[model samples]
Target chain A: MSFEVEDRVAGATERLLGEGTPFTRLGVSEIANAAGIARSTFYVHFADKSDLLLRLAARAMDDLRDALDRWWARRRSGDDRALTECMLRVIDAYRAHATVLAAVGEVAGYDPAVATVWRARVDRYARRLRLELEEDRRRGVIGAGLDVEVAPFVVTWSIERTVAEHVRSSSPTEDRALARALSHFCRSTYA
Target chain B: MSFEVEDRVAGATERLLGEGTPFTRLGVSEIANAAGIARSTFYVHFADKSDLLLRLAARAMDDLRDALDRWWARRRSGDDRALTECMLRVIDAYRAHATVLAAVGEVAGYDPAVATVWRARVDRYARRLRLELEEDRRRGVIGAGLDVEVAPFVVTWSIERTVAEHVRSSSPTEDRALARALSHFCRSTYA
Candidate 1:
C-alpha cells in the first residue's frame, strides 16, 4: 500500500474507533465511504475488516514498544522520578490507542494469529522489565530473596491492569491520580 | 416472558457464547434457532442483542462475585496456603467465562452503560478485598500504614490481568506459577 493510502486508512480507523461504534460490525462499504475511497480501493490496501483490524492492532503494539524503549533510554540511573515519568509516558502511549487495544484484547479469543501477536507483545514488554529487575538485583538494590522471573510478571500485570482501568475511566484527573498512585506503589515495593 | 422462554433464551445465550462468535454480532434468530424456538420468540425475552449481552455479562459477573465470596468464606484467616487456593479458584471461575469477560471489556468503550456496570462490579470486588485487608491490619497481620483503598485495586487488577493472560496462554502453568508467586509476594510485602 502507498503511504497516502495507508494514511487514509489510518485516518478512517481513528475516526471509526473514536466513534466507539460496534467495530466488528462495521461494513466495508461504510469504511470506504468514511475514507472517501472506492470499495475496490479498500481491498487493494487491506483484504477485509479483520485484516485491517489486525494491521491497526499491530501498529498499536509496535508503537507501544517504541514508546517504552524511548522512555527507557532517557531514564537516568538511580532516579526514581525519571522511572516514574517513563512509566507514565508508556501509559500515555497506551491511552493514545486505547480503543484499538481494547478491541484487540476482545477479539484475541476468536483469532489465534491475533492472540499470538498479543501474547508475544506482552511477553516482550515483560522481558524488558525483567531485564531491569535483573540489573537491580545485580546491584543489590532489589532484595536477593525475590524471584526475579516472577517479579517482572507481578509488576507488569499490576501496571498493565491499573493502566487499563485508568484508560477505561471517564475522568482524566482520576486516571492521572491512579497512575501516580500506581507508579508510587510499584517504585516503593520494588525499589 | 414465560419462565420456560426465559430459560431457553438464557440457554441459547450460553451455547452461542460457548461457540465463541463475536458476542455483539450474535443474531436473535441464531439464538432462537439454537434454542429450538421461533425467531420471534427471542424478542419476547430480549429487547435486542445488547439486552441479552448485558444480562449475560451481569450473570457472569455475579457468578464471579459468588465464587470469590465462597472462597473467602472457606478460608481460615490469612493463611498463605488458603489464600493461594482461593486465588486459584477465582482464576478458574474467570477462565470458565473468559470469552464473555473479554467481550464485555472490549465493548465497554462503545457502551457507557456496560462500562458503568463493569466498574461497579470491579468496585464491589475491590471493596471486599479492602475489608479483608482492614481485618488483617487490625489483627496485626499486615502493616498499619498501608493505603487500604489502593491496595485493593492493585490486588484485584493484578489477579484479573494474570488470569486474563493465563487464559490466553498456551502454557497456563506459567499463570499458575505467577499466581503462586504473587500470592506469596502480596503476603510478604503486606504482612
Candidate 2:
C-alpha cells in the first residue's frame, strides 16, 4: 500500500518532469495534485522532496545495474558490441529519469543524507568493477600491466560523471556520439 | 584594493579550515574575526559564501592547471615519470585547499551561478585535454584506434574526480599508491 502510493507520486512526478518542470521548482503539493493524493498524504509516504528523490534515484541506479548486467552477459558470450550495447542501455536508463537524477545531484551537494546514499551506492559499484577487473585478469583478457586497484575508481567515477553530465546538458542528437565515446573509453581502458 | 581584501579573507578561511572548522558552519563574522576585517567588509569584497568558494575554487583550478603544465613540459622532455610527478604535485595542490574545494562541491549542487562557473571551467579543461589528445595522436604517441572524441572526457574527468575524492577522504600514507594508480592509468591508456 505504501509503495503503491509512492509509485503514484513517482509516476506523477515523472509525468510532470516530462512536461519540463524543473525538479527544484517542484513541491509536495504539486506532486500530490498530479498524483491524485491529498497533500498531507505526501508526508505519510515521504519525509520531504529529498526523501522522494532518494527513493527514485535508488530505483534508477538499480535499473542501471540491470542494464550493466546485460552488457556483462553479452561480454561473457564474446559479443564484440557488448560495451556499446551496454552503454546505450545505460544512457536510456538515465534519459528516462534525467530530471530526477539532476535533482539528486542538486540536492546531494547540501544534503548529507542524499550524498551518503549516493556515495555508498557508487562505492558498491566500484567494488563490483574491481571484482570484474580481477576476473578479467585471471581470464587473461586484460594485460598484467592493468592496475586493477585504481582503474576501477577511474572507470566507474569517470563514466558516472561524464554520462550524467552529458544526459543533463547535451542535445539528444549527441547521444550516439556520447555513447560511442563512453563505450570506446571502457573498451580501450579495460577490454 | 579589492584583491587585497579577498586574499586576506581567503587566507583566513584556509587557516580556519586548517584548524578544522567546517566550511558550511563558518559565518561571515567568523571570517571577519579571522581576517581582521569588518563584517561589512566581507560583503564589499564578496557576495556570499558560495561566491567566495567559487573564487577560491577558481584559484585552486588554476593551480591545478599549472601543475598539469609542469607535467606536460616534463613529458615533452621525455621524462617517463611525468604523470607520477605531476599527480604528486596535483595532490599536494588539492591538499592545500581541500576544505575550500569540498565546500565548492557541496554548494555547487544547489547554486546555479556557482555550478555554471565551475562547469565552464571544467569544460574548458576537457577541451584542453581533447587538444592534447589530438596532438598525441598526430605525433603517433597514441594509436589510430584512439577515439579522440571521447577519451579526453574520460581522462580529464576521471582524473579530477578520482584525485579529488582521494585527497578529501583517504590517508596521507595512501598518497603514493593513489598517485601511482593515476600515473599508471594515464600511461597505459594514452602512452
Candidate 3:
C-alpha cells in the first residue's frame, strides 16, 4: 500500500477508536468513510480486519524497537540516566499508538494469531536484551552470580510490563519514578 | 456441591481435556455424560459452562495459594534452598490441576471474568510478597536500594510468567534449573 493510503487507514482507525468502537467491531465501510475512501479501496488494500490489526501491531512494534535501538547504541554501563531515557522513549513510542495498542492487547490475549505475532515481537526484544547482558557480563561488571539466561528475561519483562501499565495512565513524574525504580533494580541486580 | 459430585465433575473435565477438547468448546451435556450424571444434575450445580470454569479456577487458585502460603510460612530471607523448594511445591500444585490451569490460561487471556479473578489472586500474592520484602529490608538483610512499591510486582511477575511457561511442558531437571535460575536472580536483586 502507498504511504498516503496507509496514513488514511491509520487516521481512520484512530478516529474509530476515539468514538468508542473496538477494533474488532469496526466495519470496513465505516473505516473507508472515515478515511474518505471507497469501500472497494479498503478491500483492495487489505484482506480483512485481522490483517489490518496485524499491520498496526507491526507498525507500533517497529516504532518501539527503533526507539529502544537508539538507546542501546548509546547506552553505558551503570549510567542510570541512559536507561531512564530509554524507558521514556519507549513510553513515548507506546503512547503514540495507544488506541491501537489497547485493542491489540485485548485481542492478543485470546486470538492465537494475534498472540503469536505479539509474542514474537517481545521475544525479539528479549533476544537483543540477552545479547547486551551477555556482553556486559564479559567485562565482569554486571550480572555477577546471576544467570545471564534468566536475568535478561526478568529485566526485559519488568520494564516492558511496567511501562505497558503506565501507558494507560501517565504523568511525567510518575514515569520518571517508575524508570528510577526499574533502573535501581536492574542496575543493582546486574551490577 | 457435594465432594463426590465435585470430584466426578473434576475427573470428567480432566478426561475431556485429556481427549483434546478446549474448555470453551465443551458442552454441558458432554460434561454431564462424562461424569455419569444426569444433565439436570449438572445445571442444578452449575449455571453454565462459564460458571463451571470459574469454579475450576477457584479450586486451582486456592490449591496453589495454600501451597505457596505453606512455603512462605517457613521461608527465610536469602535462603535459596527455601525459595527453590517453595517453587517446587508450587509446580507440584499446578501440576495436580494441569488440565484446569491450561484451560484457565487460555480463557483468562480474553475472558474478563476469568482474567479479573486470576489477576486479583496474583495481586494478593504480590501484596504479600511486598510485605515480606519490606520486613526483610527493615532487618537490613535485603532490598537495600529498591522501591517496595515496584520491585514486588516485578519479582512476582518474573517468577509467575516463567513458571506459567514452564508448566506447559515440564521435567524435574528443567524445573530445578528454572527454579535455581529464578532463585539466583531473586536473591541477588533483593539481597
Candidate 4:
C-alpha cells in the first residue's frame, strides 16, 4: 500500500515537472492532489519535494547504470563496435528520461538532499568505471599514462554533460554521428 | 570613482561567497558594509547580487578563455606539452575564483539573468573551439569522422565540469597528473 502511494506521487511529480512546473512553485498540497491523496500522506512518504526528487533521480541513475553495464560487458568481449552501440543506447535512455533528469539537475545545485543523492550516484558510477579501466590497464588493452585514476571522472562528466545538453537543446548532429564520434573518441583516448 | 566602487563591491561579493554565505542570505546592506560603501553607492554600480555574480562569472569565463586560447596556439604550433600547461593554468584560475564561480553556478539555476549570461559564455567558447577543430580537420591534422559539429560541445563541457569538480572537491588526484591525463585525453581524442 505504501509502495503504491509512492508510485502515484512519483508519477504525479514527473507529470508536474513535465508540464514546466518549477520545484519551488510545486506545493505539497498540489502533489497530494495530483496523486489523489491527503497532504498528510505526502509527509508520510516524503519529507519534502526534494526528497521525492531524490527518489526520481535515483531511478534515473539506475537506468543510466544499466546502460553503462551493457557497454562494459560488450567492451569486455573485445568487440570493436561495442562503444558506438553502447553510446547510442545511452543517448536513447537520456531522451526517454530527459524531463526527470533535467529537473534533478536544476534542483541539485541548491537542494542539499538532491545534491547528495546525485553526487553519491556519480561517485558510485565513477568507482565502478575506474575498476573496469584498471582491469583494462592490467590486460594491456588500454595504454599507460592515461591516468586511470582520473580518466573515469573525465569520461563520465564528458558523457553526462554532453548528452544532457543534447537533450535540452536543439541538436544538429544525428544519433549515429554522435554515438560514432563519442565511441571513437573514447576508444582512441583510452586504447 | 565608479570603477573603484564596482571593484570594492566585486571584492566584497567574493569574500562573502568564499565565507560560505549563500546567495539567498546575502543582501545589499551586507555588501555595502563589506565594500565600505553606502547602500546607495552599491545601487549605482550594480542592480543586485545576481548582477554582481554575473559580472564575476563573466570575469572567470574570460580567464578560462585566455587559458584555452594559449592552449590552442601551442597545439597549432605542435608544442606537445601545451595542453598540460594550459590546463594547469586554467585549474589555477578556477581555484582562485572557486567561491564566486560556485555561487554563480548555484544561483544560475533560478536566476534568469545569470542563467542567460552563463549559457552565452559557454556558447561563445564552444563556437570558438568548434572553429579550431574544423580547421584541424580541414588540414587533415584531425581525422574526418571526429563529429566536429558536436565534439566541441563535449570537449568544453569535459574540461569545464572536470576542473570545476576538482576545485570544489577534496581531490585525491595530483595537479600534474590530472593535467597530464586531461591534456592527453584532449590531444588523443581531437588532434
Ranking by lDDT: 4, 2, 3, 1
Model 1, runs deviating above 4 Å: A19-22, A70-78, A109-113, A130-151, A170-176, A184-191, B19-27, B70-78, B106-113, B127-151, B170-176, B188-191
Write model 2 residue lDDT over B1-191, tens digit each, in one string: 66888889999998887676656568999999999999999998888877788877887878877877676555444454666777788788877767777667656655678778877877787787788778878888886656787677667777777777777668878787777776666665553
Quote the positional error of residue A140 for candidate 2 in Å.
Answer: 3.6
lDDT of 2 by residue, A61-131 (tens): 88877876676556545444666767788888878777777777666655678878888877888888788
TM-score of 1: 0.78
TM-score of 2: 0.84
Rank order (by TM-score, best first): 4, 2, 3, 1
* lDDT per residue as tens, model 4, A1-191: 56999999999988987786666557899989999999998998888888888788877878988997787677666565777888889988887788788777677766666777887877887888899989888988887768888888878877777787777775535776777767766777555
| Sliding window of 10 residues with minimal summed lDDT for model 4 chain B | B169-178
Candidate 1's C-alpha lDDT?
0.71
- Predicted structure with the largest DockQ when compared to the true one: 4
lDDT of each: 0.71, 0.75, 0.73, 0.78
Model 2: per-residue Cα lDDT at residue A88: 82
Of 1 and 2, which scores higher on lDDT?
Answer: 2
C-alpha lDDT of residue B157 in model 3:
61
Every model's DockQ:
0.34, 0.44, 0.34, 0.56
Cα-based lDDT at residue A92, candidate 1: 80
Give the residue spans of candidate 3 off by over 4 A.
A1-48, A166-173, B1-44, B169-172
Whose DockQ is higher: candidate 1's or candidate 3's?
3
Residue pairs in clash, model 1 = none
